[model samples]
Target: TKMRSNGRIQLHSEDPHQLVFEALLNRGTPGVIAVDDFVLKDGRCDNETYGTCDFESDTCGWQLHNWERVTSQRISLPATDRSTRSPSGYFALAKAPGGRMVSPLKWYHAAKHRCLRFWFFISGTSSERLNVTSVVDEDQEKSLWYGAASEASIQQWFSASVNLPAQEKTPMVVFDAATSGNPGSAVAVDDISLGNTPCPPPGSCSFDEDTCNWYNAGDLTNAQWYRHRGATVSNLTGVQLDHTLGSKEGYYLLLDAEDTSARSLGSMQSEALTLGPAVCFRLYYVMRQNSGASLSVGFLDEHHYLDGRATTVKATTPSQWTLLQVERTELPPMFTIIITGRTEQGSSDIAIDDIDVRSGRCTTAETDPEASMPPTTEADSPATSHVTEPMPSKQPAPPEVVTWQSKTTAAPATTEPLPPVVCKRGEFKCRTENTCIPGSLLCDGVYDCLDGLDEKCESGAQCKENEFFCVTRTPSACQPRSMLCDGQEDCVGGSDEALCGACPAYFC
Candidate 1:
């Protein structure tokens, strides 16, 4: 069952209405389980509630931006250079006090549901002080939250409208950045983008044209970082490899096809390349046995056809060059990534290049934070996207450097140990979705919390005083689950669960 190309190509920005689908895996690939780059290095994840890794800032080396679109003029937008962070401070627009804020790929330690946005840049006199938080899964003190900032160089875009509740006492949404009047000024932040609102080319979802060509199931090509995409021989000098790294050090576009018409879907010349929001794909050909061959890789925006055509996976391994990855959401804005070698009953040879195009992560759930958001609601939220609207109140940025004394790393978690709590009620305020046990109620059965863990039980089923039944069988209902953990599974597994219940007492 190994014939997947995920067929994708979607990442559009000048905002046509936003669409999404071309993917790259903040993590995913052939065998991709490669962990242990291990940098929390001296003791962490021992799991206190996941808040360690003093690697602090400088973010591993940065570079991890699959996508983002919060608005506030990231200066000149189009960015993708990437960074989990670089710091200094000064920003505003309030409202962000919980559900996702740790840092560095995989979202440091917390992020559930996803979709929170922000960005701030400043020019100085803004002495420093910024601390915004979002810790959902690594739950210490219940999903924390914070927010605050004075001003300088100023540019802003803060939003939070959905997806929190992965657990950790749940309520860690904090922000408190401070600044004086002009001391150093150079605070940049391209952060806090929670998800959903990604279309109009927001990742190139679909285009549909197929006779003149316009097939974007999501594949616009341009992953170009380490460089890799259907290469028969990147630079093996002349072609050497037999041992893994010599001869041809790294070259593999090998798939010996003989039937299935030698499946071929490489070049359709739909304008010579420029159609990937997802069309369709197929690689790895094999039909070289009784002259009966197979080779495939076909996509159709238009060159003649009538029904969803894309074949090349009929009898399996023709000798293997197979590595087909597609994402398919129906993109046809001029499509063609063909390579078809067909054989109804005779000669076949299916051997194609190494065409790689994978990138997808765009959806978390949100619907508020001031104008310009229509990346995906199916449609209807883009009254405007060049971004313009703030005269009613909370959207008047571009001023701050009101100094007092400071340094920078966004200069204001102060090193953090936790416990400051002011979190917006709305003085033009913001921040408040770490909701562990405030006013947002509905956990029934009793014990609002002297320490019943929040009610509802099952596994060991105890009813000490509030009707404890740790055995709702497991569907106990918590709303937004998955702090990881579901091997054989159970609800909201937070430390991946092992403190007592849902099977981790030492397996099966």
Candidate 2:
């Protein structure tokens, strides 16, 4: 039977796989084979038909199973991949833990126009993953898509369309799904289709089959960018990696240097982009232990490094995700985003996410052009100051009678302005008040402020437990790391001498 464009037909068959094969392999009908809903059981069916969304057909080469029926009440599933098919029912993978299903592989001759489209719903946690792989040249396998389980409270079906490139040998596609042990982890798929058009770009990613956009480029041994579900440090302390909690905004990129002993550099670069004039670039970033660390981004011109400008920001612990925006007026033919992390001996992890680069002019106004003027000459002015002669006062003016204003009629009451709270050279302002406290006293387990704002600190610093911090002075110094442990009274309060034994054995 030949399928017409934008046509709908319902075939009655106990074996759904047989119908699919008849539609795909039927002679004289070189058209697309589309499946609206899982042919097995609809979502409205009773629980008795819950695990029966699969069937076998003698006409088809292989078995067709793996997906099962699920009710729409559990999830707000999409009824269609495109508007062409809708009002469909729900279907999901076998909920059994570690259970998986694979679709029958069919061979297709090499063709430039090959694409696959489908709608899928994922729930539970990050443990649940769905992957689509294809094989060409008999043994070579290529992954098309990989998605972890969703943590979102409300599960929504997402549509995906991918391109299938021609190969030297025929290609076959397979759909794979795995359960993460959660009964609520609903993994539903519907509206399978094949087409000739190319797939859309996966957000900032180059292709739907590739990994994320940001990647490590510098010395991987010293430090590297890591993908994390949340902002967290590694488990092993001896390795000296400090993990943070999640970015609170889903997936994030992290640059860690806890393991590196000496000065190291970690560079995470973004995909190459051709930027337009006056684009606003924004991203959210977090800095754990900022000491001796910095993050920067720059644009490279055609001459590699010539005519490029970079902006760098020092690390600071923000209470939550912090926004950083950069506006560039000059447009480059092409540019690569380079985010480099520099570490001096020791540093904490740095994380960034929610990167957005779009077309738009900056909000700031353009500067006025310089005014044109002639050069001034010394002849324009006299050597001595010019004075005007005061008119001779006729006799002494009559004694002026001063009128005294009444207190009630005094000018509006004005209070004296409070003095600005100036902090010491090495300290920061406390959230509680304008009070300045030593940076060392901050997060030192001691409540330096009445409100204890100074003590509110984020975990994971490079300092040792026994080390003494003298943050009140210029160039904040740490005991034992300074002149204190060498039998010299370097600190005015002798804190360096007092904490001499606290210094590490190697330092002595």
Candidate 3:
């Protein structure tokens, strides 16, 4: 008997002869092959039926090599499954000494593409990495995504979305976790699903995937904005987690005042954006009490010049994230958003996240009416300043202002003549006082000058042969050449420790 393309069995006989066939029946079949009575439509498998997995009760048909179903109590890390967000929830976990976990092969077809969405938790050193890949063929695999947890993300779960392009053949999805053999390190994933829908559109940014076209204005000030995850390096200053994810695993734009001089300003400029008749800009910010930090949002023209007045806000609630919305009308065709942060030698840091821009006036439900900007004629308070221009025939609400105290005061007049001091080639003159100090004392991480002038090294400033100049940092910085590659970041920009040779595995 031969099988035909139509799946029918036909008997072929070259010599025609009388043939008698007897059917044999037995109470128990010795060997039998069973086939599922289902046909795949268009040779495509439903992702909801084949690709979705929660790992709550079991591995959900996924083959696990080194991974196992685990609960929060079983893991040393303080993380809950994304599915339930509860300690009792279960998730697939791969501990240090890891390998690959794979899903069953399936053929997927969609109008556009399939999106794989999952929540992952990684708690380990930099050497530990978790990668998601799809095996297209016997020897071909395409990487979907890969990431490693930082020191602050050990307790937080992060979400990931990957687009799976249409393939000619069925593919097996694989989760490969690698480690540096640290017994405490681990990688966890839960609540995975594949669907035909594309990933949601990201607005301006949540600061979770880089600054999103926003860049630090290098010439603004010595204080620089850093893209950071988890709590800042300083103590009792910045937020412990980002607002978007409410987890340390998320990213935010931070302006740390701890490492910068007093009254330092840090500015971030957005890419040029088109504006409609009316626009609303929104963002989330945190400024701790006594942070001495003030935030301002304003517009800039295409030429990078300020187009209008900036709306500044001060810290009100300590260590709490506040929502800020600014509504503008009669805006230029194209403009950029300028976010500036200023610190007055305070201990707290300023952070902002989840910036969004949209057309039309900010709705009342989305803004705090009580916190709206007051009229320009409102007298300035000691701890806050409310400034706005007179409205035209069409009232355009000014940006909401949360302001801080201005500690600056006019200097008293002095009649006495001061003596002038001249410094030698190897000496440095103080900017605020008539004093000179040796050039070697500059940027020593200490304030040797009365006004800290010796510590403020300008960009392109000449340094001694034995000094290492940190050219990347604003206002620059200098350190002893011997301190280069010492593993410690003495420069604000970490230029001192950059380009250092990699450390040995054991030492890392």
Candidate 4:
């Protein structure tokens, strides 16, 4: 039967090996005719119905019809003179623990397409920090999309259909370690395929799929498509890699459940930095839970970079998925973004995904044509400082007797302006007073954050004010890492000089 665009390749025969093309039902009454030489190409299936997807088809004149019959022998690959339709030719090339030779899980992307799909039989890995990744260009050095998993059980299989980029080449398949690394478990992949078909958007009147302008193609308008983590309070989805999990992508903050931090470079932002003009960006994220949410987003000027500009703050919108739309005017070209989320003080397991940056031009008012103007020369200076019609020399002697008019003006409240929390250095706002906390309150036996930000020490940097700073009190006890926890070694002689702050900044 011809494969229709929407219709799936259905296998509905009593013979198990019917889908095997050429097979010999040597042990059953309802047998199948075995065909000849055939070779399978890059294959896999991530379609949902297929359960776990993989390439299981054997391209030999001898096919499989559920151990039933052997018929015609004329459809296999150009094998050596020893072209035996034998399973012996098929051997497990690379075996990871718990790998199934039947259906090996493989991931791939199209060079220029829209969707990626596949199926695989997956076994649990022994290592928790294990994952299988889909790679493009084999930048083994670096890739963009990566993230964590949801389940732990193994053996049973599932299909996955990841959305592919509209502008990339056919990608290679990879088994990453985002989920638990079951060095002991085996994974099977099968039936690999890809295509760029028009996806009818929900409630749309447009039919033009060429540009994928399918109705809601309006950038970031669909709220349902967006995922959120009420607890993690993320603005965008983060790429999960290795085993360590939490709000990672374009977000950096401490997780309430654990003392470790996630220092995703994208989120390690600077407040007072400069950006070249024509600045803009868009970020996507998937939240794992529903809870309180508060994030931050802002640019930086050239004000403060004393220590560094590595600052991130909780920005707008919590408990909902969103594409943070950012724009800047007259910004330097190379500015950065720092987004942070701390769910109401004591929560973890937030999800994040898909972060992208785009730019556009500024209007004349925002960025005038004459970008630079020369300093005023002496020729442009006025002879007199005051504009009193040049009446400075002839000004009458106006002895002004200061008449004290004491209208009972209410004195402005003299309360000291609260210190800026400085979540994001020169860029983001100290909106939440005491958010970053002063070193004093953290360990100074004093309560600093009236809002209790002092107690909420992120990154476990709990060096309170007036505490034993490495400045004077050297370490008496010997700890491999810095016991001070100020991201610095406390040993006067640099004994505890190991990499102390190896902690990422996103996890609390």
Give the Cα lDDT of each candidate.
0.27, 0.42, 0.57, 0.27
Best by TM-score: 3
Tens digits of per-residue lDDT, candidate 1, 163-268, equal 2334333344443333343433233344333333211111111111011111111111101101112322222112223111222344222322211211121122
Scored against the true structure, residue 405 in model 4 reaches a CA lDDT of: 11
RMSD of each: 23.7, 30.5, 24.0, 26.1
Q: Given candidate 3, what's the lDDT at residue 501?
A: 65
TM-scores, all candidates, are 0.19, 0.31, 0.37, 0.24
Candidate 3: segments with Cα more than 4 A from true spot: 1-203, 261-263, 366-508
Off by over 4 Å in 1: 1-123, 134-175, 180-188, 191-224, 227-508
Worst 10 residues of 1 by lDDT: 218-227
Which lDDT tens digits does candidate 4 get at residues 204-234?
Answer: 1111111111110001111111121223323
Model 3 is weakest, by summed lDDT over 10 consecutive residues, at 400-409
Q: Indicate which candidate wins on lDDT.
A: 3
lDDT of 4 at 284: 31
Candidates sorted by TM-score, best first: 3, 2, 4, 1
TM-score of 3: 0.37
lDDT of 2 at 234: 39
